[model samples]
Target: MCTNTKENDMDIYEFYSGRSFDAYRELGAHVKKEVTGKKTVVSGVEFVTYAPNALGVNVIGEFNDWNETVMERCYDGSFFKVFVPEARPGMMYKYKIYHRDGSSMEHCDPYGFGMELRPAFASIIRDMDTYRFHDAKWMKNRSVCQGSPLNIYEVHLGSWRTKPVFDEQGNPLTPEEIAESNRVAESWYTYKEIAPMLAEYVKEQGYNYVEFMPLSEHPSDQSWGYQNTGFFSPTSRYGTADDLKEMIDILHQHNIGTILDFVPVHFALDGYGLARYDGTALYEYPSNDVGYSEWGSMNFIHSKGEVRSFLQSAANYWLSEYHFDGLRMDAISRIIYWMGDESRGVNDRAVDFIRNMNQGLKDRHPSIILCAEDSTDFKGTTKETKYGGLGFDYKWDMGWMNDTLNFFRTLPFVRGEHYHDLTFSMMYNYNERYLLPLSHDEVVHGKATIIQKMAGMYEEKFPQAKALYAYMYAHPGKKLNFMGNEIGQFREWDEKREQDWDLLKYPNHDSFHQYMKALNKIYMKEPALSAWDDDPNGFAWILCGKENDVVYIFQREVNEDKVIVVLNLSGLVYKNYHFNYENGDTMKVLINSDWNKFGGSTKDTEKTIKGVNGDFGFDLPAFSGIYLKPVD
Candidate 1:
């Protein structure tokens, strides 16, 4: 059961359902009401819009009149939004729209808090009081959801694999009909058929989380799941909302966690389900300058009261309804574009939106993990909400990815291959609050395959090539490797074709995949490898030298129980590595990359060595890595 406390520190919870956060931390959640001028107003929310088309708009709610809470008569059309009222806990009502041509919109409830359960009149009446214990249960269950070295498997259901679509009633829906429904997700996948496979495979290979690429309902197919049409509704393409829930449930059962890539930054261009659903701007930006996005997504006017309330509620809804453990808010930096101040500065509006959403979750579920993908210079964007920053568990590390790729793309011995780029990656890896990413963006659309990238450098320089894979496991933060990366897949990832199975038939190429499998196994066994999976304290840098082979890192959590990965980039074996630690002297031989077990020559095997010190060293075989433990 969720804890009952008006004010309490967030608690960690675990269950088959996704993790939730306690909402009490979010004052906005408890907002009986607030007039902007009354407090130290945080950005990300306001009470204004640019509805030039609507003939007349009015604010309606439980406070105005129970049965006739419609505000149509009081509206002047431009932007008629009501601010948060004092002590109006869980206001539930909809806009009474007045259209042009002498027509009064009836049976129209855009922006309804809880809709009617009947057809044509969507039930929007959701009593805030009914959702009790969201934080407590959420916190407790998050404890059950363990964090490990993350290798995200980014998936878009419509195009992730291939499946069928069904109507709300469980009947088959034709492709053409689904297409006409204005839903962007024309692709599909059955949870029963996919989750188990993905879970089992991920666990077998050593990935910790699966980032479901934008599961929220949308209206564009070719645009991918980026354009959200319904923030609350799961796309009807792959399966029903219930099916998506079960899919996550099964993934958890398999000991794997899930990451929901949420897109509150903007709505779909068409704005079918979420856009103008309230007959006015319920979720668009305050104006085009702030709401318009590069991708044509309907920008959420983060500077409005109603939109702010709606987004915060939507964040909680997934946790309350579908059990989403975490959220990866897509393209947050672009949500609010700023013309003044620094070019990279984020609009203050985004700050408030993120803060309220996170606070609400923490109030009800402390165990909830929240991540945002931002490309702007939003300082402290991932700090604690109380610190006046967006309260997020983590943010995508695009800087590291870009730098590492630049280095990986370079041929060994090339001027750019100077340890500078690799060294730069290590320096900037932890620049953000949290990071664990391996998206389809790198492989698809002609970005080149991971194997191909390595082949560019490693094909001729096997030792350096092997170093890339080894360091990924050896790094001291959350890690993200795609599906085929576990075993070497030669070609880039493609939905249209199968992974490079032909390469596996050959001894050398097959060994690369086998080598990757061994790497994952050893990686999972090491605490150092997973320390940065969620928290900020899991990693630290020990050494960064001009020599590529001379770099050293500490997973901070390394202990006697862990499997220490030691690799040498030298072509010839190096003997008697200078020891650094001051621990016991015998080292346990775990496994070696050069061993035939991974399709390599048996160059050398690790022998237990004594250790205990601030610094440690080992004898490494040429072009290989070995796992070990300390012994007396």
Candidate 2:
């Protein structure tokens, strides 16, 4: 290696991916117990800190020897130090973690506010508590107490844009610059651009909140934000931590809340980062007793004190420094439960710790919302914390997604349609303190697209089924839609692939947009559809099981100016179909799925419907659903 530069010399080591694979993996757990990671300050190229487990971590700078490792890390509990071989501006370095168990790993900085896989690429050393600002200082001005009324728009950074790229390693890449190139085709976008654009779009579309997939840094180019490396930093590929701050500021300016999709369940086995900051034994758990996720990664030792510091710091940091309105914690089901244990994986101590986290965040900032993506039957997740709950404002109703998909998939033409199941979902989906979300998870990974999920007979069935999806929007619960769903995006989400933006030119695509806009009209405009969303009596329905078909009447707000949503789940069109409602002057048709614009020729123009003989009968199109507002 060349020397005579401005830097010193250091030892370099390597642990190929294929070398000691099992041992390498075991090290993730071992550190938590024996030599859990320890953080140390290092004066090397670029001025960065070194964690205890950094294996063969050495400094490489613009000066000094060009070796991979120089200024090797030396430890004294307070901090880790390295000469940086003469740390210089152009100097680059990488942390090398080797396990006493003979396993090795490499990764980027975990606490870095901005980071690259290796060094010299630039990384921000962010201490969450280091920042000082009091913007949303008086959160009490807002009447929305935690879960008063929150409608979230979930987004994934890599897929939300239309540009894509690949790295030298054949890894899928999403460089953040595509946001400004304005290339809505096969590209990635930067935070500086995406924030303003998304805020304006959501403000116009009438959504109150924005939920982003994980923003943490990671090495995998195509990662769906699930595999994380820099827990304390925003992905550098997007922009600096300040860019995210600017984005959130814009969102707040628009009165749209910001929520981060957080993954505290596990940590990526990054070799160059926190994994082996001090030594292999330093932050990680002692043995394999700590579980591993089905997906390849290191699980957090939730019960450990140091682990608690790391995780809690992460949660509170985002809320305070970034001004995030909330956090949607991913995978709570895996946190305190074991697979197939019937939700019996009870870790009371860990559960209490999570509750304490809620108190800690709110104690500092009372307005922060904490939501969970929990699918288990845990009873106290949403109960008041005073009652010994986990203190989450709400838990996602994952069962409803399953029930809805199952009902839609079993088409009568293919598999005999089951009306009872549909009624069952309607009856129980919103039973608990919950939220309903057609999350991004459901639309990808070889599962048929949402439109395809509704395909029954013809491409014609597409819009008809979509009409029912509109009904879902008006359902009595908090509503959430992935980024592209509002415009009827036709492609499966691929981290490496961009959205098919050209599809919007088609009339069908345009119609999907109009259709969704109409549903949101009811969702955002009507108090009956929103304010009382968590109240069940606010949503009551009656199903008349016809011999050849079924008809259901959904009523919102009894003894008041109310809306009635009727679904005709049969193949035949019926005129004067018997339906009864409290005596009202007439009824106005708000929306009908059977329209020529929406790939349907059965156009039913808006009209006033009347009740006859204590029964309101109206023309029902074949396989159609309608939302009607009872008029005076």
Candidate 3:
């Protein structure tokens, strides 16, 4: 028998009916203290799950030696819950559900706050209020990113760093010891240990925010936290839920905001997960035709009200409980179109669900950001819901990323035909709030690293890469780059290994690293470069369509201060490249990618130049770019 019937309430029923956005706090495992006897207070946990189609349900866990029938359901047939005085925090548990066909299955809690590490799938009861955060200053000063320098460094936590092997005398181990230690990939740093290190690195790199590539609990390491089975639980591979909270606290103390890459479109297909709860398709679609996702996972049935409440509650739990600054929703293109295919026509049910969910989250936390990685030409993605839009704060500019990368991949002799790729982004720049991203998607699956994507031999890629980055920073919109891009790391990202840290020992790579630092510092310091990114007046083209020399020049202006950017894509140097510069009386070289410091050959040219009748000319280096600031 269950411990008590007096604690039964209508909250779980409301949750099942899709009315509770905070269902995470009401359903699942909630710890409560009850006065069982005089002068006696017993602290226990209440387990609630919605399994309306099940013949019977039982709460099984370590507290009862995996007993199957110790608990009882409530008065309502739609929900089942039990209060166990013996169920305390840190105990493992799962629901033993009996089907109408006389069969039974054990499934993890849909709203479990914690879960055991892989190879052990039981849910762990966690007290969410145990950790006290000290990020009041950051929280108080935080604002939604609008016309601010929002440069994000996206990282996969495990691959960011690994544990180092050491000898008995406390000296660093030899390569032989390292190879043996790293053979099985067993060494990993806990969240509490890696927090300060990651925060320090991000600050030194001059990024204000860090976007994690999904930290939720998943069974397989290869999925990189994308195939999540525990949406509400931080993966135990790092540490406990409190450990994750501590990590966030440390980053907040360093004044570095955290953005979580959230996956809401689909879930892992593990049997113990949400695939077939209550011996039926409770959280996902039943038919395989419309049920499965492109990644071979079950798709969420958004038309169901209960599923909508469940997904939104999980989203809110991250911001409210973990203190996350923002959410970069993954695979939003799937939510806009059926099976993520534009040819499949728009999915009306999923579209409505997105609008409703986004509006609800906005109502609760207006200062938190919601970014969508959608490639479709879906208008009003960044518009407010009241104005008949999807209500996202920012949308990934996939078209711009593809076009720019393809242009760089084209050889100089043929780049003239694709010159429009560089200028085409501005044609629809104002249609939505966009974020220019060179994300993890670009560097994986044989796509090659950012530097390797340049159209040249191994050594020639460096100069063009520097030119590409200069153009990206000078271009409009916020910025996001994957972890290894800044250091000119040539290897594609792998989930199992740390980034190539030793590459910095090389002179060319180290110089490229310093160039990135200078660019980031300049981006943060110059208001003319980032202050009015969304405003059309912030950018003006000084020169375009010079197909012969493959040269382009543009200016980013704010409050009358301007920085002119010039790019020469051809391999041939021009002794004199002339362009019309408005107010060119005091033109000075702000940054020259062709300077000797950044692994370039052009060092004899003068850093300062003067204009005659608003016309300025300078020695344009081959396969390089420069930023010129008009001092007047």
Candidate 4:
């Protein structure tokens, strides 16, 4: 190792000091033009990495025939850099780190912009600045999702669409050495291939945003990109990084926003990963008790300044580099408490790190969203940082998801006892900005799909599911449903398989799908349903605390426009259920969840309810929900 050089060591100190949130661009392998002489210029790649404990570091790649002698460590003892004039984009590379104890290990660049596919771990040099994005209009008009309609369609990019194996080398398949390339569901579609299809489908279903389950590089297919390795690199399984940008471009062109699921708490325990890098627990905690996560991965040590810089830089890089509209941060409760166990008490260091990062990201990009999937009632999780809060734009309403799902799981006769589960959300609805999520977690690993979670037999579940979605869409918060939930998919989500697209052939499923589409369109179109979501003046419970009928009604009001939503969770119809309406307000049925088109008993009754002295009546259908709007 050499002594510290004034040139490279200056910014190196700032990176370790933790102020460099944009360290991804400064620390990674970047393409730069160097002047060899007064008139001569050379274009090459500059490789830099941080391994303070290593005795020496060298760059080995295709450019040097995998030889370590070509590029030596710079004068900075904690940092290494080498400029290769011959190195160009698409050249695979790795850093050979020699420990103080004479042990050497080859590791991928921590800040590399691109990575090779699994079974082969190496970072590739790719220039990110050249690609031109044509989303100027989308970027200019984008705003924070405080009072806007945000219906997100959560999708696992690889399994969202599996086409016949067209490009074998580029496809994400199960067996790496399988002889036969052609089979049923042979390969997962790349980001570019699926972008148009996903955009069209999401738009048709009335979703404004598509939240993809993580796109970062991971070795295991089963991890579904959650156990990430390359934070900056969009996984090679879905084509190059440029391809992902193009995909987002197409989505933005269609007026659809893109959100990437980010896992900042932990990382995979792969040998080539951040685990034991530089022959020490640099990124993770030194002890396994705190270091090892529940998912068999290593938890990031948020206390360390360098680690904080790395994680925060990774978060910023995705938004700035890829033009992502937002990040749905996964498992944020773990960051607040030790291993996500509230009993272990709050991790103050980690909590502070989260606040600082969120505030910093907000300062840099005011319009982008930072949503936390926190189950804890951590006060100020969604409050702005200036008010001593965690400073998230939105928080996943896990309480609402749990209570609603559990209520639906009960038999209709017993549902009256659990009716409070349906009404419990409003108690804390104003605490923080919330988004009701029927996420992928609710549909996998022995937890049945949303449709299957409903109580009763096959035939009985469809109507209930239809009513459930009606309630979800009609509820106050923004909405996010998993990939196959719209079509009422029965099977648990599998990473290897695509959604049950063929299920649309069945009348019940098709009708349920159509119902969701209609409901979503209405949710987006109706100002009463969407606008002023965060304001308490927008929502109110009309019918509650009724034990016998298991019926509920709510009013979503915006400005002068108001929508009355009625829900019947029981199997028996109630004739002439009386309710009050404002005088001179012309009320009509906007959407009947029990209509025949939705595989329900009721017909489309555009019946006008003429109110006398602020009173009205309606015959409620069994296992149905309806929306009544005040028309002219």
Which candidate, 1 or 4, would have the higher lDDT against the true structure?
A: 4
* Steric clash pairs (candidate 4): none
Tens digits of per-residue lDDT for model 2 on 487-544?
6665776665556666778877777776766666666666666665666767777544
Per-prediction TM-score, please? Answer: 0.69, 0.79, 0.94, 0.94
Candidate 2 vs candidate 3, lDDT winner: 3
Off by over 4 Å in 2: 1-107, 117-122, 126-149, 163-186, 281-284, 339-344, 413-417, 426-431, 544-548, 558-561, 596-599, 602-605
Model 3 worst lDDT window (10 residues): 1-10
Whole-model Cα lDDT of every candidate shown, in order: 0.54, 0.61, 0.86, 0.86
Which of the two, 2 or 4, has more lDDT?
A: 4
Model 2 global lDDT (CA atoms, 0 to 1): 0.61
**Model 2: lowest-lDDT 10 consecutive positions:** 24-33
Model 2 scores a TM of: 0.79
lDDT of 3 by residue, 359-453 (tens): 98888888888899999998889999999899899999999999999999999898988889999999999999889999999999999999999
Off by over 4 Å in 4: 1-10, 34-42, 70-76, 165-186, 605-607
Question: Which residue runs does candidate 3 get wrong by more than 4 Å?
Answer: 1-17, 34-42, 165-185, 604-607
Per-residue lDDT over 55-133 for candidate 1, one digit per residue giving the tens place of the 0 to 100 score: 6644444555634322222123333433434214334344445556544444323222333221223213322333322
